[model samples]
Target: MACNKSFSSNYFLLTPEEVGFFDLIHILFSTTKFEEGIKFLDMSKFVSKPLSELGSGIEVALNLIPSNRNVFVFMLNFLRGRAVKPDKTSATFLSFIGLIDKRVELDGSIKHGDANYHAALSAMASKASYENSACIETIVKNHWKMKFLGFYDFWNDYQGKATTQAFLLRDKTCDQDTIVVAFRGTEPFDADAWCTDFDFSWYELYGAGKIHGGFMKALGLHKNDGWPKEEVKQDGKPPRPRAYYAIRDMLNKLLRQNDESRYIVTGHSFGGALAILFPAILAMHDEAWLLERLQGVYTFGQPRVGDEKFGEFMEKQLKEHRVPYFRIVYGNDMVPRLPFDDNALMYKHFGTCLYYNRHYEVKVVEEEPYRNYFSSLGAIPKMINAFWELIRSFTISYAKGPGYKEGWLLRIFRIIGLVIPGAPAHSTQDYVNATRLGSSDVFVPPKDI
Candidate 1:
């Protein structure tokens, strides 16, 4: 496959730029760019939350999703629903998937370049899952308790409030003291966009261009004055405009007040990619070359970073130490599982890899990834959605709302949810007029971008 003119099969697939990743030095030092490098560093890609004029545009998802059940189902469905690209080595196991002729009906359009969109509409609907499920299972299969920390929940802290990132010390009896922090993606669900604790302008220094004026204003740092406005480069080219200092600051904060001890990194989807870079920045800071002390790195839904050579070098570096710094994807999940080989998306030079972690496993949670694709469509038919979607003003809103009940009602509602179908109980929305949610609004996902 190396330097072969014949691509494995697909053409657009070969675009090196398409293979975005987090396994680098500034981006992949294994401790800085990706905080989860040490353990399961679950981040909702915290720092990447869109800082828009209208605020973080999280409402697009809200308007589409009417109830709690739908939201919950959507999250669960999409979490493990990435289509797998067929490979020569493991094609035999695919064995005419039992669910092959069964495709889910879509009430709307599948995202172009979006696998979930393809899975819901394409013939291979039942085959997709998160690329990292098996890898995540292996790392925690033997654990006494698995703690799930939603990366979005850190919004308060990110907004300058407080966080549970270092809450591990609270649990004295917990074994190994390993934690997994999870974050949400842009599709289907809009993760929380509370920019509280961190310096707004500093975070923007990491972003491209003058998009973040509020951030600039907050830090008394201007885009032209301090931050460099450079087009985001996906190749091996370094991000020069944005300084890694913001990321470096977060790392310093994470390990600052605590007695750093046993830790590892883990994340799902985007968080998985961030895991590599978070640690990398930290490694650079450690005068002692602390990167070598890492126990392992296990991320599900991990994406490729940089060119193949970079991925190789990361693998080689980690493998030499018997550490599990490998990106593990399930056989079926199609989140662009890169060639973990030397010519990989990240760590291209050298990497030690074990194809499948024994403990890694996939539990087919759903017969179909999005069974209720029809219901979510509301009135839109699958075929006609193309034109209608454009006409409709795509609105997204996220907020704290009243519950169905305060006492017995909450319990009754919970019970009814089991008996009858439901939507999301918890939700967030955007107010078109205001940059904040309701009157106490602070931030929102960008309307554009």
Candidate 2:
């Protein structure tokens, strides 16, 4: 299947200013002091202008900083006494920060806007699933109606010792017992995450080539071994991703212990890719009981995982089991269209895509349009088209500023493949906004079923 061409609903939309405000908040929480943090915010131009006008200033600043430096430090050094210059806007912003700080101290979560506005905005918090201590802390304290149960960190030995992280969360206020598996996405500023993000080499898996080798290794599958001999034809099947064995073992124990609990898997970006593959692996191995207990799989800005055959396999299994796989796409999120949509590359996306248009309208479609192969030209057209779309989207959203649109600036940046650290549409908070609004009417299967 190819990309969806339409949206399903128009529920809520986050304004450019509001996007800037949240971006500012993320920046503030990630800094050491109000002054220091505000300095970066000022540099990003995210402090005074809408993010659409200035682009993601936070991402640009993050690109310049060292990767080892912790990006999300929650401590706020409130500037008091005569040294402080109090202005109305700064005062109001500080007051807002103070409120968030209070909420963090009190309940570990801060509400984004008014509760009655929309569920999406209401459910957003500063929480993210990064490797940073502060990010983990915020997630532990926040994350709607869920309590942190445990964290699983896996190392990809095959892929230059890369690390992947996931969280196991349980419902804090459970009407029916539920366990949530959340995965962390690529960190725009972090070198490790960048490495993972760019490691797009394909490996053969389940009779298909072009599966991301790095991701396969990260999932705990090895080169020598293949999927369980009983499951697939052993001729040349690649091993399961390396890290998944430990994860599967853990989930096995959990499922055995709580037979009645429903499991929901979720992630953003790269993590979203993992979330999609996790269940597919389980189902492929004929783990029927585990598949039955799976309530739903939700992903935000997930890239295409495998070829058309892989997608077909996944869709069939998921549909037969009645599992609702929601692939949430935000406005012009380049990641979803990535690893290049070339037919030769053999990459295809699975599940129902719920795309949020430029207006943040929700469009639901079964699959994206398939790009047909054209002789030796292969997927070049598709690749170029996807890349151009990304460039166009990025340009419209971020390159409209004074110096950004200049001829030399555009040409140089294009030649160097310079990218703004984070895509605004792909931000975790943006996903939260979309999901909260879209999931209001979603049905949650019973635990006993």
* Top candidate by lDDT: 2
True lDDT of residue 426, candidate 2: 52
* TM-score of every model versus the real structure: 0.32, 0.58
Model 2 misplacement above 4 A: 1-127, 131-138, 141-145, 160-162, 172-174, 207-210, 228-242, 367-422, 438-449
Which RMSD does model 2 reach against the true structure? Answer: 16.7
Best by TM-score: 2
Give candidate 2's total backbone clashes: 18
What is the per-residue lDDT of model 2 for residues 273-309, given as tens digits with 9 covering 90 to 100?
8877888778767888778888777777788777677
Lowest-lDDT window of 10 residues in candidate 2? 5-14
Q: All candidates: CA RMSD in angstroms? A: 22.0, 16.7
Q: Write the per-residue lDDT of candidate 1 for residues 56-142, one digit (tens) a residue.
A: 233323222222235666566557773232331221211111111111122133332332221111111111111123322322232
- Mark the regions of model 1 whose C-alpha exceeds 4 Å error after superposition: 1-175, 179-260, 283-293, 319-322, 338-449
